[model samples]
Target: MSSSSPSLARAPHHDGSVTYLGPVPTRPGGSVRLRVHVPAPGASRVRVRWGQDGEPRLRDLTPTPAFDGQWWTGELPLVNARTSYRFLIEGPDGARHRWLTAEGVSEREVSDRSDFVLDASDAAPDWVADQVAYQIFPDRFARSAAAADRELPDWAVPQAWDEPVVAAGGPVARQLYGGDLDGIAEHLDHLVDLGVTTLYLTPVFEGRSNHRYDAVSFDRVDPVLGGDDAYRRLIDAAHARGLRVLGDLTTNHTGSGHEWFRAAAADPTGVEAGFYLFDDQGYHCWLGHPSLPTLDYRGRELRERMYGRADSVVARWVDAGLDGWRIDVANMTGRQGGVDLTREVARGVREAMTRVNADTWLLAEHFFDASADLVGDGWHGVMDYAGASMPLWWWLAAPGARPHATVPLPIDPLPARDVVATMREVHARYPWAAVTASTVHLDSHDTARFRTLAGGGEHGGVDDGSSDSGLARARHLLGAGLQLTLPGVPALFAGDELGLTATTGEHARTPIPWDARETWDAATLDAYRELVALRREHPALRRGGLRWLSAGVDHLTFVREHPAGRVLVHAVRPRPDGAAPRDGEVRLPAAVLGGDAADAVTLRGEGLVRLDDGDEPVLALPGSVGAHLWLLPGDDLAWT
Candidate 1:
């Protein structure tokens, strides 16, 4: 906080608050409570204009006589089509409108594209919204002695357990450090200690490549990784420890070595030939990569083999006790050139999962804007790179942190205000369920490690590392605070909690150095543990309503209101100038305390605030490098 002095509150009404839009996650044929808050408690009349892309219908709102409040409401039913809505309020002055978009309030007309979007066809597993995910790359995590005792495949280049990994697509990609299912099973305790509820593994099916996107088969777990039985054992063990394991699946394509592909190549007229986009010119492969032949959904036979049937590959794994499937390259699946059936394929998978386990999650991996597919229809959630991580990089990482970031390449530093707005835009497109269930991460196997970006190392085309180790470490902790405090199923890329540093993602994938505890950043790990515990312990923090309570040039503060309680997260960035930043003050929203800043704050002698009823708590800041968290009682939370 810059100062402890109280400041007048900004009017918080009609700005993405439930007070303005109630009973969120609007569904088809269901009524939603649309309310608008104003400076004054009551208005003469309020109208809601809702419709499809080009047409809109209006309904007059009647004030609820029950418990009179500032929020004027209209209850209306949504139809079968995609819904878009805005409010028209009638106050003493005249008629004015309120456009509630992901970008917050706008009086002028916003394109139907920007209107609040609701896809009732889309709904994620309710359980995922409140859980955190822990990502593990099976090839480089930890190798149990049992896995180490196995023979190496001819295609794999064996290396010592502690050796650094080489990054390349051919033989280098084929190298193995021997981490396997048993190793993850052995480490369930560590994940549990970190308060993780989900164990998300990279590809583990029969495959030769270290990343395993090039799978030879879908039904069997690679024997080198302890095969099918090991997968079951891992699943059973993970379940015993109250953790769920989701395996990776590549529906976009299959390796050249896959039996169907090999057979199809030899006999174009064979039963499997239709699986590939084969023609007189040749077959189509993902990104024109010859080894990864794109699967053709035109072939019902292929769709049935993959996800359509109860006996399909998807069902086999779900029945094998795996909790879910993480669709690899989901952006490319069922999409080639202008042709697309991505939703059909995805919906097929969702139906298959429903057959096996109604609670099973279905996540898609897309570095770009996945809103086209994430509209709540098929995918339970997404590895939400576009929505969260990339925007963060644009703000926190160096301008040149590209080729290293997954999408929306970081070419320049984004203003703090722009970052918050972009996040709101991405978040507003989905229903509350998908928004909360989306997976948010700092770095993963597909990109350079986040710490590397913080270190600003230029190793391998990456131009990051603009700060010294000490300051970089603090920023990383702040990143953790933001990731955990913001929405999404917060995920850790295996070694991130240990303050792992790397030049590139490949280096970041270095085998977990179990023997190098003396060299680890213990403080970073402890902070991560605390943040995860914070998420685990509070239901509100896990799944809550978010409001940007305060934002400034060098500082940001937000409140997450949940049913269990409300929590505040504040983070700061180093000043660009080579001078100390002045102290900052963050004024909590009056709506949060159910009164104005000067009004005696509610929840006195309750929640995390220790002040008496008359004292309003204000955040006082010290320096630039800081992150703070506080929990407050939610039941007493009200916007008066």
Candidate 2:
């Protein structure tokens, strides 16, 4: 339970790598080979304690013939739906026993809840981990000429494409810019050139607000966004360019104007009334927002209408060509007061979607700890804001800055060690597949833009191409590098690569400045493009297991290990004196660098120099906010 050092030396390490665990999507009821690396002789013996038919079972691990004396190998029975296991390492003379769970090595007995889990239920689609997703807020992305002809709803306060976005007051949600699907279809080449593999569009259903979380109907796309035909065109265009498209769905609640809500409010005695919680006082709304009415999943009719049936909303969308869905407020879905059908709803939706298309990638939007909900049967993964974004925000945030209004509590900048620890601890709770499939992003439609958080412009302020934006842009690229290289699907908010800045979620919805190329931050855009390309080209960054190497105050080093190859990542921010840090030396096992005969390493990005002509590798870290990814050479076992 105490803090664990991030250093690789003397640490027992295990990840989802093929070297550690074999045959991803571990076979049900089949023996799976597992390995653990104990770099030092701190333990005389090691054993794997796993779950079996409601009881605990132990199996001895023998030392592998290679990697000198660090590697130990064993096989897990995989008898349960979710196989939970941890290592029991005995010190010399069987003293100072240490338990190694997903949380790291603990000297005392620890909770088994943090134990590494291998789900025998189902894995995410094979493509989920490999995708580099780009998220677009529908109304703010772009507006085609065709969009100007469409009539806006009475609730809309239309604005020109170049007008300032109203980031505050009640009018913020009503200021619509009329971006449509056709507009997005026109920009397919931009996304392809940026090297993103998937396009994640925010809700397109008929909604009252510019953000569209408040859907009035699930049956069709908003007419103002060029209707269902435009939607088809966008999907076809994206797919033609080898990109997958995902849609957002709000399952936790519906806009008060939704047809189902209207029907229930009009007739209390009707069958539609059962779809929501209706008491004598009034109906229950999500988080007390009257405009957004929460759904009650206790009744079978609501379930059948949402996702339980072949003709349900969930199935209809997949049939319409959505590669997957990102369920909004999924943590609150089906759990209000005494009724709790969250799990059942997730499983039902997954079943319904897969029936239409087996490869559908389902993701949940959970802002807080989502480990308990990601057991592999329901959502393929979560947005991972709690594990990835929140920690990275603290690490990259400027002094006295907060993430956004939604995250009201103040978060001071975190040291690299604490950030790494937070991320490691939170990720340890998820099944390996869930961890890999989760979205790793800096910001999203519901949060402040990363550039603003890193001290770019005023909170919610638009980009002005000012010199003050340099710090924000550098830190933004630093975080973007981590997002792309981490053990998850990297997602880039639409305008983040273009140096966008915002103080809050509403302000963050500034329209993409496609026409104003001169105002763009070309350097930032190039960094994103290069990073995305690196991730796509290297198997280690796309589908590799992560191993922490070292964590310093201003720098972090890790290695992504894949069977085909290995990559070393070193990320550093500027020192207090604004000089490049020199103490970035991290010694790896000789085997990790291909034992003495390792091939030459290729460096990407700025501020890393190889001084490895001597004994071990020593790196000169970046003088500014920068990152370096080294393509390492190694064989399957010894890396020689």
Candidate 3:
């Protein structure tokens, strides 16, 4: 069948009032209860087909209607802690000849692969779903007014507070403007005002460079960034203001200046010799980079010192008031030339962290598919760039004035269908638990700033859309509105709301404009504030299952439904040159939004958005370059 196949039949969809989405675990070895609504009145037979995790064979079971006679319930004997199932509603009053499954009533048979999965063990920290995180680059976020940061390492090139870190520089990563933890603590009020409850600081450990992927030690914070005492004070202050701080760790390799590596290199027969893979040629570094050497997790001593032991790095920081960690280059860690111990290492780290704080969230910096690492055993989730952010950026953000704008990944704008299909395909591969816990980000320290590319910060050409500040802000706001309605912790990079400009990754790491913030656009900041508050106000927006209503070439309309309620988000690009704007009305299926009659939904928005929840609900939108949101009452909690 086509990807654009009609999800529902022309006749009234046989949507039962009963929900198929919820917690499915019923304890070990206990039967899993499942139900589906037989919305078609007088429907008699409803059969359930299910299979164990990834199993091809599905056992069939029959269900009987309850006293209300609207839903059919069944129980499947537990096979494992995780499995999937689908409903086959037959003997309906009318319409489809085949049956109904999780994807809705269909004339064509739907693949059982799309069946709803139940994993009792799939759980992450509850606080993860409710968080709105701010990503901060330690060396560029802020600097103290009194602190003189001019005295820097010989390898680094120091710059003024307001200067941009040009991509074509003498030493890119090593350049430091000296933003410290104490500075972050000083600006706690800024974060609280922006409604950022979670703070993600890129590595702050002792290292040769500013980026700090190359850690020189495991036990101490960098003295350049105010050292151990400064870190402790910063965490305490952040916590006092109700902010959770997350640290960054690199398990893949160690800096050349690290004590372990220097000692191992001096004597091959030393105790730490076995900790790394050393050949006759030289050291076994990460990707042939001599400055960084990969650790061999096969060594019991290395594993114990890094994560497995109670006093190890993972356990120490998590217990020391840190909320969690973001593992750097996690895909390459614990794997070298067929030696794969990624799971073992991650599980060890997770166990160590769990000993201190069970709520500790462990995420990974994976540039590719990481479903294998997120299978309910290791990391809670990843940065999620590959799954959603990168592709969405390619489609939504304007291609800016960067030299090599055409990287391997698609930079050309993709149609709305392609965007929707890509997200769905990536999401289907992961368990829903991992999906919601992942960091849904637009851009980070490793990528070009989104505002520079999309918000018109990089004025490439007149038609580029950055020249018109109002148009650019509105377009950027649409993206923010759509992202806030998505599941996962809404991750916002620092200075993004300030309309910062940067054409490349190095440039994106430019310092926050604390000294000259008065020049920033107030409208853009208000848009961001409102979007963050909107997500905070609704539980459905934070952790809802996406149900796409329509995907046009220039527009995306979807409903996010949680037990609490449904949030309708619709976004459309501006009208093309000499072309008329789209019709200001969109009709959605009544059942998808939890209402069968018009006026069932009560809308609250910043602009015009009218809702009529009839059998086929219609939303009257007013502008081409605008996003309209509406909410309908649901059986779930009013708010989490």
Residue-pair clashes per prediction, in order, are 13, 3, 3
Tens-digit per-residue lDDT, 1-640, candidate 1: 3333122123223333343455544356776666554443345666777784467888886664322245556675667546766666565466454554555656677766655655666466667876788999998888888876788877888877777566544556877889988988887888998888899999887776787788988878899889988889999999999898888899999998898999998887898998988877788998888888999898789989998888999998999897889999988899987889898888899889889998888988988777778654578778888878887777676546553634545547665667887887776666555666678988888777777666534332222223356656666777787888787889889888877666566766777778766756777788888888778776657766776655555566676765356666667776444355443544442444332233322221122223334353442333446667666556443433
TM-scores, in order shown? 0.89, 0.94, 0.87
**TM-score of model 3 relative to the true fold?**
0.87
Error of 3 at 373 (Å): 1.6
lDDT of 2 at 552: 64
Over 253-321, each residue of candidate 2 has an lDDT whose tens digit, in order, gives 999999999999999888779988888879899888889999998889999999988889999989989
In candidate 2, clashing pairs total 3
Residue 504's lDDT within candidate 3 is 72
Ranking by lDDT: 2, 1, 3
Q: Against the correct fold, how does model 2 do in TM-score?
A: 0.94
Q: Which parts of model 1 have CA positions greater than 4 angstroms off?
A: 1-27, 34-44, 52-54, 62-69, 90-96, 168-171, 403-411, 456-467, 576-578, 581-583, 588-624, 636-640
Query: Top model by lDDT, which number?
Result: 2
Candidate 3 differs from the real structure by a C-alpha RMSD in angstroms, to one decimal, of 4.6
lDDT of each: 0.70, 0.82, 0.69
lDDT of 3 by residue, 1-640 (tens): 0111134212112211123444545344666555554433435465666675546443444444322234555566556766666656555656455555434455577775455555556367878888999999888888865347435667677777766576656778777788988888899898999988999999889899888888889899988788888899989999999999999999999998888898898988997887788988887888788888999999898998998788999999887889999899898899989899998888888888888998888888887778667654688788887777865775576644231242465356667768876776666556677777788886778777666556565531111223555555655666677667777788888877777656677777878778676766676678778888888987778876666667666667776765677677777765424244343344443444445324344443434333555454443443356667777666631221
User: Which portions of model 3 show Cα errors greater than 4 Å?
Assistant: 1-19, 24-28, 35-47, 53-73, 76-78, 87-116, 149-151, 399-410, 459-469, 575-584, 596-623, 636-640
